[model samples]
Target: MHGPEIVTTLLEMADDGQTRPTPSDAWHLFLSGLRQRFRLPSGRPLAVIAAVLIASIVGGFGAAAGSWAAERTFADLPSQARVEALTRQASPGDDYSYDRSTSAWGTDTTMGALTVSDWDPASARDRFAADGWQVTTVRDMSAGALAYTNDPATGSMTPLPVRGSQFDAVRDGVFLRVTGYVSPGHGTVSVMLWPDDTAAMLPLMLAGAVLGLVAGWMLAAAGAYRMRPLPAGRRRVATVLTGLAVTALALPAFAFYVNMTRVLGPSGSFVNTVHSALNASPYWSYSTPRMLLLLTVTGAVLAGAAWATMGRRGRSTPAADQIPTTG
Candidate 1:
């Protein structure tokens, strides 16, 4: 029978009170129905098993490839040097040093200190402007510092102003903040630079992974439904169990294969190690586990419902055959 007709029949039997069976009974009947419908070459069952494994492997690898591509794209974003050059130009005579610099696949941030003998906010702003940096605002360090707070409830810290004069600017895609502090004999300029694109890239990476997962599941399901059906009187419970196993195994198998092939080194062995690359992968950490559980439960429930419907149909058929015919 066609996929839709089989599914519809199962659903109708599930909805009909007389035919509705318990979850376990329904699953058994579903497996029996599948066996009967797909009774082709004797090797049909084995082929279905192989198809599920192949589908899962393709799905897992496809997700991994897409995720890696996203990371590579993010890595191509503009670097902090784009802003640092402007800072150097703004404070030519000052001795400059990077206070802190951090980088990830999609983002980079650098904070630098410039030691100068004099503090001239106006001259600094003009210098930055001449170098194509658009001055955003100039404010007293004390006023900016007032915005800093430690939230007791959340235990989160907000940005605090450095001990100096504050200047904010934007050039190209970089956000720059320059703070100048003047003492009796010493003055210091602080430069902070960040790219605007990092904020948007993270969400896109996560979204891409999710989309890949869904596409994989649909492909596997469709392939399974369209394959040759199982033979009649095949062990109903065994068939249902095998389906469940396939559903559960496909995701982890895909995850393991991808992780081992892509993340592990040539010398690396997949022995008794508890750690896996999938666990470390940002995209896979949460999504893979949840998808595995959801798919397994869904497969079991569907099988049970299909089995129950088939059993109801079987019992009703015999009774109908036994009934007296109108002459």
Candidate 2:
């Protein structure tokens, strides 16, 4: 109980493996350490954190913008305005020429003189319903019935790594061509030039950003986040960046799941064409199932990371016990 004895005891505890700090003490130490390491006021670290988050999150969005803009260069996206202009310029004697600007990513294809006896987006929905085909992509046709599974209602995005036909168009009651992606798990049934009105892109973007940050942070944190040889500021950066990276990664995927109204859709045009083609050939098959595996794995990772984020307050915990270190 003497002052010198108390000093000896405290020094022992500081260096002792078994000694543990109380939660409150740990919190104070953690904050003081963080401030000293980051070389900023307590408030400044939060601002710095927000900046990285914005970079990773908003930068991820740049992926889509970049995708759309770059894709537009090679493949012109079909514009409603362009279609309208063509519809007007053509006379009864002249068949209207239309185009399906599926993705600015690629493919700038125009339609067959695809004369439109009538063009209506509203009536098209009715025609789709009558055919037992739901309106996945909600674009009105100039003169045919076409719909995709991924709704183009919510956002302007194409399903990740688009699997099957990217668009659908039906001409003259018999001619149908639906184009989309056919990736490993899910395939696409692109009814319009874009992806789901569903929010897949946002999450995917975050996943990419988080992945980048996690990777970058790992390199930094391996040396930075520790109790020894204090890399101090870099350590704090690693920690904050890590948290920001994780949030960036998980938020987007969460948005997709919470809005589970949409699925990776297939094209009704493809379905009808297959039916018609089967009537003639009697045998053919091209099927793609749920990207659920990717979704599942992604969900597991994001869920685990999110869980870790919630639990990881004011201290570092070894993660190997909670989840896999590598994907």
Candidate 3:
């Protein structure tokens, strides 16, 4: 052919819809390639939804794990030596009658008796403030009870009253409660400490959530792909098992989160807030043995289904049409 004809033919071929892909077509092809490569099942909205729910549960677990791990990075209770030193430095003239220091449930406490001193509450407050402590009078305990009790008239929470000579102090993200009765020459003193480290926890929890989301998505994709060829009866059973497994995982995490919210709510002292934040108690408390048993059984059944269907072919394709045979 002449060069002009050849050029015209090339232009026509380029313009043909089937000859070249548009940007949208290319994007779709790329996505399709990815789906096939990953063996992701398509055309199943329920499977996708189930995967999303699974991911949410897994992501919650990751966040909880991250928060729990982050708490360990901070000291929940101050050292015994530091507690002793603070008491000695705070009241130099007073001699100790008894010294008892203990740690429990995210709180560190020290109590001792003094053989009488002229030190009053004001002086103690000033001393605490001088030592970088933010001092404030403790709130009335009655107010805390009132917060939970039903208010027949208003049904709204009543604010706590800032009364009492007992002091609550915070310093460097650590909380301290100072309580005692002091007179002209005798008294008992108690100091309790709780630590807070929320700054580091937030970032770790976010990272954990992202990781969990990815893992959950991949797992869901794999499960959907594996069950793509399952018979109707077997598929129904598998779907039930999946639902049971998701419920088993979700309930504990939901219960734990709710409890944490309640514990961290505005009702009690800041001491309670710090304790709840650092306690990390719900992981074990909510994940009971019965829940674990349910999860295990569902998982086992699903695994058995997969094993039983191994090496089986999908629904057979219809035989191709054949031309009529000549006599």
Candidate 4:
């Protein structure tokens, strides 16, 4: 119908008592308004968006995979049982107390102090050496300590002794160190045991990242293709939500990997020991479980939106058809 005739017909329908609007009418009108407002990108712009979305997915998955691999590498380290056993042993004439615990990030720490009468540094060194430990003095440990936590002036525990004499050794990939504070006739010795698997973990983490990148790329490509049929407005919203969810999912992985790197080596000018690194900042700032829950909720919402709008074919009306036409 022509414009005037169409308007008159609509006015006549509005005057009829039976022409009342239904709930469905309001809903369809709302959706129609949204479709007009949020135009979909076509051609090159759409392709570019798909590419960016795919990249985000791939990167997030890569980092997550690497972090998981790194954790496995740590857990696979030699003999936790043996390490725990050695960590609990104390020499005769020494009053010892120790505590052992594991962190959320999968680090095992054994720390304790020993009170001994007649503090003899040589005897202490020899005793550890006899246990097949290549013991070294605190001075040597300070010099050879990991650059990540070596601060001589601050007297931090990067394998350094606070007072008197300190000795440490590395065996079976475990760190064994003793810090002694001696007085007139006796002394208090602090002992710490830690596992060092950095040399084995980094390469595995890199490999995992590579694998995840490939997997994410494939998945993103398929997902983008599936979303092609959705309306521009819905597609864009879904894409943004998916991107953010992927980012949230991957955050802990990358953060963990970075923290591990810092713990193992120097992070710019900032230094960190494994204990201090895991227990401080970023890692301690938020809950991993909560971030994961967010990812799950976001995914569900995206899926529900898609199911509602994408139809049985999981496709929307063609982008070309949605474009306005004027004569």
Candidate 3 Cα errors over 4 Å, as ranges: 1-46, 80-119, 129-163, 166-173, 180-189, 230-244, 259-327
- What lDDT score is found at residue 63 in candidate 3? 61
The 10 consecutive residues of candidate 1 with the worst lDDT sum are 267-276
Instruction: Give a tens-digit lDDT track for model 4, residues 1-327.
Output: 033443344445564474654577658757864453333334547545644544544454454445444545442333445543443343334555667755544355677776765456677677778888877765322333222344689877454333366677766666677666644445566667766555544555455556655554554445555577777887777666665655554444455455556545643211122222233223555655355435545654654564344344333333443334569
Q: Which ten residues in a row have the lowest lDDT in candidate 2?
A: 271-280
**Candidate 3: residue 245 Cα off by (Å):** 3.0
Task: For model 4, name the residue pairs that clash.
Answer: 229-316
Q: Candidate 3: lDDT of 169?
A: 78
Q: Report the candidate with higher lDDT, 2 versus 4.
A: 4
lDDT of 2 by residue, 85-179 (tens): 42332212133344553211122333323333233333444454455543345432223323234546875544333222222333222222333
Q: Which candidate should be chosen as best, given lDDT against the real structure?
A: 3
Root-mean-square deviation per candidate: 16.5, 20.2, 12.3, 16.4
Global lDDT for candidate 4? 0.52
Give the lDDT of residue 77 in candidate 1. 26
Using all chains and alpha carbons, the TM-scores for the candidates as numbered come to 0.39, 0.26, 0.51, 0.54
Ranked by lDDT from best down, the candidates are 3, 4, 1, 2
Candidate 4, position 56, lDDT = 46
The lDDT of each candidate is 0.51, 0.35, 0.55, 0.52
